[model samples]
Target: MRTTNRPASGTVQSVDRAVTILELLAVHGTAGVTQLARELGVHKSTASRLVAALERRRLVEQVEDRGHYRLGVGVLKLAGATTARLDLAQEARPVCRRLAADTGETVNLAVLSGGAVLYVDQVSGTSTLSSYNWVGQHIPIHASSNGKVLVSELDGTELTRMLGELVAYTPSTVTDRALLEDELAQVRQRGFAVATDELDVGLTAVAAPVRDAHGDVVASVSVSGPSFRFDEARIAEILPLVRTATTEISSRLAHVPPER
Candidate 1:
């Protein structure tokens, strides 16, 4: 058994080696198991296991079953997803800014990632009060308006699986599974979602789904501010603006609504 250099803190050695194998194949176009073992400074069996795992996931494919492998279609699929996410953020920037200006509240773009709402982009409003920057932060899916809108399109089983446990972030958070399900149904019916002091005390947010070309909810657009400022009348006033902004973003993503 040969010993390879240990990975950095919090990094899994096997996973790191597997990724290195993919990078190696990407650079070399194709490589044999023996060659990969030599380059990775590992035993042949270890390299074979890594290659087999990637091959099982379709991340690598055997070259005509001649003991050589190359990157596979799964890599392209992952690249396409990454490109789509980048495009979604870029396309929503202007609309997010316009919404922030119109609503006088911070606007954010979020997508569901690893069972959490991942904030990808944001635009701050003109308010003097400092607002927290949520970009690159992951919030619980059950405790945010943006999260609700992102998950509103999912089916019952998927929704259940995505929300593992309804952890309460604040007193206003909906911790009940049944109640949350009902709220999600409303979000789907009304085409938007609202969270008042759910994720944090005195914070309120409203969000609408941003669809892709296939009409699937790929992300959410939201406006958030102090709960006191998001009163009933104010919510009524801003709801239309949020919905319109999200619609425009969806259109920019080539989403065509079905004709009535």
Candidate 2:
């Protein structure tokens, strides 16, 4: 689906106020519209409208007798997804540590979030100086090895919609749509991606797709370090290890490789 920027300040404030109402309800366990309006410093009618919207989505449910609202099952469903992400991180922690140790490079677990690469976990190398922290950070989808691997399965039309501008972060960043498509094709064939100074002037990374029980690419396992030390020879040496780590992680997620 095509996305457009929110056009109105009132619309943005309405969304923010709605989220604050949810937060308030979460904290107090339950609240009436009047109390929410007082906390939000908005008119009672405004609070009612926000709560009404939330109710439509099952994010909030009204206590008909008490005239109050509480968080609904939708919140639990969202929280469950987060819990699964945490589980994935925990399960991949051992493999990330081993990869970092074996290559003396920083290792990361990332997933596609809002058309970007969200780094969920990280393991540092033996050398503290070479290690970089990126846990809980989102990077552009078109500029990183992890991002490429995550989107490798997308078809041309979907790829176009997903990557709108292909903004360049560095001189080496591939901004051409056709080139990126070609690179993604190669990534699929090789089952991995290598990005050399594509996202940053001196950063390099190699990533392998991490599949889930259904054999879907649910995440990516990447080894990243300074470009100077991540030369072609070093990359070749550790590529197998990176691939193995991803396979192990996928196995932890119950993804069984088909027997040859």
Candidate 3:
């Protein structure tokens, strides 16, 4: 095999090659297995394997009627999360605070970062469940209410990629892939995701999707407290509040067309 600029150390070989394939697609629009192998200086089969992996992850997709591949909507989902962070910084802070005040529970603004939920902003309520600042924490995508809301938008292939191996965070956690799929379906149907003692024994959270102008789910807004304090009746009351906060944040984002 020949050589490329993929880092020689501190990276898995297959991962490096996969990323290089994406970079190649990004720069040149699209390429087939033969061209990609020639550019990567590797055997065609190796390049094909890398492409197949990316395709499985929805990071790359086959072009219509051609064997060439290009970047996929999954890439947009990752990139859109960054844009969501930027939009949320200014528009979502007050909404989070209001939700915290209304519900007296911790409120978090999270986006899908790879297969994890990256909490970007938080507001603490009167209920002190944990002092740990959730901001910048990467929570497993299969565990939290916020994660469920975020993944509800993913297609079947992307959903599989996000849920590689569901680690049981708690006994109540959904470990079966089919069950998790059902849960996400309910989230999409009802416009909310509820995790009751699923991520932590004493924790319960309810989340709603934050949409952009195009109505795509970009982030999730959640309100969480100890399960004891978040009974079925209590969750019922907070669900509307969570929905309202998400609606407010999404409306603000969609109110006006972005400048050029």
Residue 243 lDDT, candidate 1, scale 0-100: 93
Q: Residue 82 in candidate 1 has what lDDT? A: 89
lDDT of 2 by residue, 1-260 (tens): 11135336998878978888888988899999899988887789998999999999899998865679999999899999899899999999999999989988889999988778999999998854855578889899999999999999988887777777899999999999889999999999999999999999998899999999999999999988888888999899889999999999999999999898
Q: How accurate is candidate 2 locally (lDDT)?
A: 0.89
| Top candidate (TM-score) | 1
Model 3 score (lDDT): 0.88
Most lDDT-accurate candidate? 1
Residues 142-163, model 3: lDDT tens digits: 8999999999978999998887
- Provide backbone clash counts, one per model: 0, 0, 0
Candidate 1: residue 185 lDDT (0-100): 95
TM-score of every model? 0.93, 0.85, 0.68
Q: Candidate 2 at residue 206, lDDT?
A: 95
Ranking by TM-score: 1, 2, 3
Off by over 4 Å in 3: 1-84, 255-260
Error of 1 at 17 (Å): 1.0
lDDT of 1 by residue, 134-223 (tens): 999999999999999999878888998898999988999999988998999999999999999999999999999999899999999988
TM-score, candidate number 3:
0.68
Report lDDT (Cα) of residue 148, candidate 3.
94
